[model samples]
Structure formats: C-alpha cells, structure tokens
Target: MDKNLRIGIAVLALVGFGALIYSSNSKQARQIAASATQAPATQASAVGRAIVEVKVPEFEGKAVLGQLAYVAKCASCHGENAVGQVGVAPPLVHKIYEPSHHGDMAFVMAAKNGVRSHHWTFGNMPPVDGITDAEVGTIIAYVRTLQRANGIY
Candidate 1:
C-alpha cells in the first residue's frame, strides 16, 4: 500500500480502538465527552473565582432520556426527532431554532407559559405537568446531539 494509505488506516484503527474503550465506561461519560466542546459559556463566580459548571446528575449518562421526554411530551405536535409533526411544531434539529434564540431558559418558560399559536392552530403547549427542569435540560442536550449528528451545529 502507499505510505498515505497506511497512515490513514492506522489513524482509523486508533480512533476505533479509542471509541471502544470510551464506550466500555459509562454511557453518560461518553455523552458528556461527545458534547463537551458544545457546552455553553460560563459566567464569573461571586468570589472572583472561576465557577464550576454543573451538569445535571440524572441526565449525566441519559441521552436517550431526553429523546424519551421529547417523544412523550412534545412528539404529539413537535413530531419525533423534533422535525415537526404535520403543521403543529417546527424543526429543532438544526442550528436555526437554537437555544440562543429559543434556548434552555426559553424552553422552560415556554413549557410553563405556553406561547400563542405561532404557525399552527394547535393551541400552545400548556405548562407541562410533572416534568422537572433537569429533564428539560436533558431534552435540550439530546436535541443538541441530533443537531451535531445532522451537521447543523
């Protein structure tokens, strides 16, 4: 084989081996590392020290939990994978409808406040019952994963 081809194959092998090792640990660890680069910016601490960012505990290894929450709470109108079901909701698996515009805090508010019908007649999403803030965070994380996987981010 050519020198370039040999080097490429070696790199691929190394990457594959690394992925295997990462997977063998905990699932949440993999998700955190996978999305570490996409984490949001941090603010200064009260004591002039760098404030440590906290990731939700139950959502630590539970990317699927986000998907499940989306399906249960949002899929009816938002559709599976957040691509929009019928004329009910909008696609969220891209960089367009992002947290920057409709983000973590916004989602929490919307879930609690229920916005007016933006583009559909399906009444606003009433304040969600029984869902916690952490679950909302997980759903956002999972959607971010989809956006990344789809090359939207």
Candidate 2:
C-alpha cells in the first residue's frame, strides 16, 4: 500500500477509536447523572455520595490493620466500610477508585498533599493531617480490599 494511503488508514483508525472512547465515557456520565438525580432528596445538597453498597469481606493481615487505620482516619468522610457519606465524600469502593484508575500512589499523594477534585463534585480534598505515608499505604490496602469485595476491581 502507498505510504499516504497507509497514513490515512491509521488516522481513520485513531479517529474511530477516539469516537468509541467518547461514546463510552458519555454513557457513563449519563448513568452517573441519572443516579445522582435518583439520590434521596435529603442528600440533594451533597457534593458527592456513595455510588455503591460495599460488601465487607473478612480482613486479614495488613488489611485488618489498614481497616483499623481507615476507620480512625478516613471513615468520618469516606464513611463506614468505605460506603461513603452523603453530604461528605465519595465512596472509595467505587469503580473510579479501582487500582488501574487511581493507583496506590494516588492515595499516598492525596493523603500527603491533598488533591484537586476532578472525578467528583466534592471539591478539592484537603491534606489529611497527621497521617504518615505508612498509614496511607495501609489505608490504600484497606480501600483496595473493599473495592475488590464490591467488584470494583
């Protein structure tokens, strides 16, 4: 095939892939918006809320310790078992938090330096005070466990 024709084919393929991605993302956004509208009236003012009911599995090893740490430091906002609190924060067990999406280092950075809001309407996250990097790792482990249990991973 001629080089120009080959280049045209590649460009067309890229455009098609981009369109597919855009379509998928738009569908997801619509679903999220629909869910938000279905949220309880009392939670209408919430910046972000639990998108899924998390199933808690038996904790083991570092996960157990991580759960404890998470409860102490994160549950207030993220909610018990990471189900998240209406009017407070978004669920860590949600698909958006899957390891492939956010990664463990994202958690560490969010805890240490805080994060600007991008995924949710909950506004920017303030740096978690007094939590060590090790503690954040444990928290990530805890959240990851919860996510997996909830079929987020």
Candidate 3:
C-alpha cells in the first residue's frame, strides 16, 4: 500500500480504539451511579416503643470475607488481630465498635473513603484503594465477629 494509505489506516485504528475505551468507561460510570442510587437503607432508629429500620451496609454472612479484607487493608494499622497497633490504632474488638455504635455504613464509608480521626491522635486515615465495596462489606462482617467474640454482643 502507499505510505499515505498506511498512515490513514493507522489513524483510523487509533480513533476506533480511543472511542472504544471512552464508551467502556462511560458505561461503567453509569452503572456505578445507578447502583449507588439503589443502595440499601443505611440507618435505623427507635420510634416510641417500636424499632424503626434504617438503611445501612449489611454484611449478614460475609464475616469471614470481611476478615480477609481487614487483613489486607486494615491490619497494617489496626493490628493483625484487631488489637490496635500500640498508639497507631484502636482496639476494634470492644463494645465501642459494636454494630449499634459503629454500624456497617460507617465502616463502609470509612473504607471506601478515609475517616477523619475525631478522637484519635492518628489524625486522618488515608484512603485504602484497590479494595472494592464488596471487600469493605467483608471487612465489616469480620470486625463484627471479632466484637462478638470479645464479649461486646
């Protein structure tokens, strides 16, 4: 083929590839936005004598997976066994971290984004990237298990 023809073909291929990438990214963004809109209820409260349900992150039976996630993302500062790394982190296996207090949504938000340390001297928690929201669910489950085992109920 002539040099001009070859260059034209190359340019066309590049444009096609770019379009493909843009479309894929746009599709993913849309899906993510849609799912977030459909996310479950994340809060609850008591109304008079009846208990009101709230929308929050639900781990249910993913405790083991959450534990693995904790190992990968939280263990560094939280300690391998949730015992807290001296002054670096706080103990997660106690009453303070109980579901009623910390809640799954809180954990999910903290993992998805980072948490600002309102009470701790650690300042702010840097975001733990690479771990997906599902992984965050797993981690929360595991932390709940730990709390249960530690007599937090």
Candidate 4:
C-alpha cells in the first residue's frame, strides 16, 4: 500500500483497539476518571460567543457516570455525541452554550424540569423520565467534555 494509505489503516486500527480496551475496562476506568478535572474554558470569541477550550477527561469519574446517564437519558434528542440532530434538536456541541450563558445549573434544571425551545426550532423539551439531579450534573460534565472536545464551551 502507499505510505498514506498504510498510515490511515494504522490510525483506524489504533482507534478500534482503543475503543475495545475502553469498553472492556469501563468500570476500572470510571474510578480513574473521578480524579480528572474539568479543563477551564478560556477562549475569547470576537463574534460574541464563547469558544470552549477545556481538555477532555480520560473517561473516568463523573464524566463516565454522566456518559452512561446521558446515553440513557439525553442522547435520544441530543444525538449520540450531544451534537444534536438537524430538524430534531439543537447540538450541544455549539458555541451558543458558553458557560456564561448556559450555566451548569441550567443543564441540571433542564433534566429535572425540561426546557422550552428558546434557541432552536425543536419545540419544547419536557423533563427526562428516569434520571436524578446528581445524574444530571455528571451528564452535564459529560456534555461539557464533548463540547470542549468539539471546541464549544
């Protein structure tokens, strides 16, 4: 194979192996994730939006718990990666969700009481059925992690 083709195959193989390992060691991994801290968001946007500049966690702690809870609770509307589906829901991986505007509590409350369609045309968001306040927090952490990874804070 050509050099670039060989390199692409290697990258894909590494990613696949990583996913396999991550899933196999999920429980142990979550413990380690607890020690991870949220990367601070500090990018300035001249267009009046906040760019997320936080580092992603290594799949441990609350973020992990949140990831589970999110898969169960929020992923349906928010999309698998919280990137919201077009004509379905708005992406959580966008700039409109700067910490200054959509505080952590907003996510918490939104899970508890649902939210109105203030930003998108996805209509109203009713409260989630089987998640708790604490789960919401962790889920927010997971969402933040995703947003940061996508450069949205």
Best by lDDT: 2
Over 1-153, each residue of candidate 3 has an lDDT whose tens digit, in order, gives 999999999999999999999999767755543332232344222111111112223345687677677888988777665765433565566455678878888878877788987534445787788879888877877877766666666
Clashing pairs in 2: none
Clash count per candidate: 2, 0, 9, 4
Tens digits of per-residue lDDT for model 2, 46-104: 54556557678998888988999998888888888987665567778877788898999
Per-residue lDDT tens digits of candidate 4, residues 1-153? Answer: 899999999999999999998887765544332222111245222222222233445666789988898888877776676755544565676666767779898887888898986655457889998888888888888888877776666
Q: Model 3, residue 32: displacement in angstroms?
A: 41
Over the stretch 12-97, how does candidate 1's per-residue lDDT look in tens digits? 99999999887775465444333322223452222122111212223335567887887787766555666643333545654445
* Model 3: colliding residue pairs: 41-55, 41-56, 42-55, 42-56, 43-54, 43-55, 44-54, 66-138, 66-139
- Order of all candidates by lDDT, from best down to worst? 2, 4, 3, 1
In model 4, the runs with Cα more than 4 Å from the true position are 1-57
For TM-score, the strongest prediction is 2
Model 3, position 121: C-alpha lDDT score: 45
For each of the candidates, the C-alpha root-mean-square deviation to the true structure, in angstroms, is 17.7, 3.2, 15.1, 18.1
For model 4 the local lDDT of residue 45 reads 25
What is the model-wide C-alpha lDDT for candidate 2? 0.80
lDDT of each: 0.59, 0.80, 0.65, 0.68
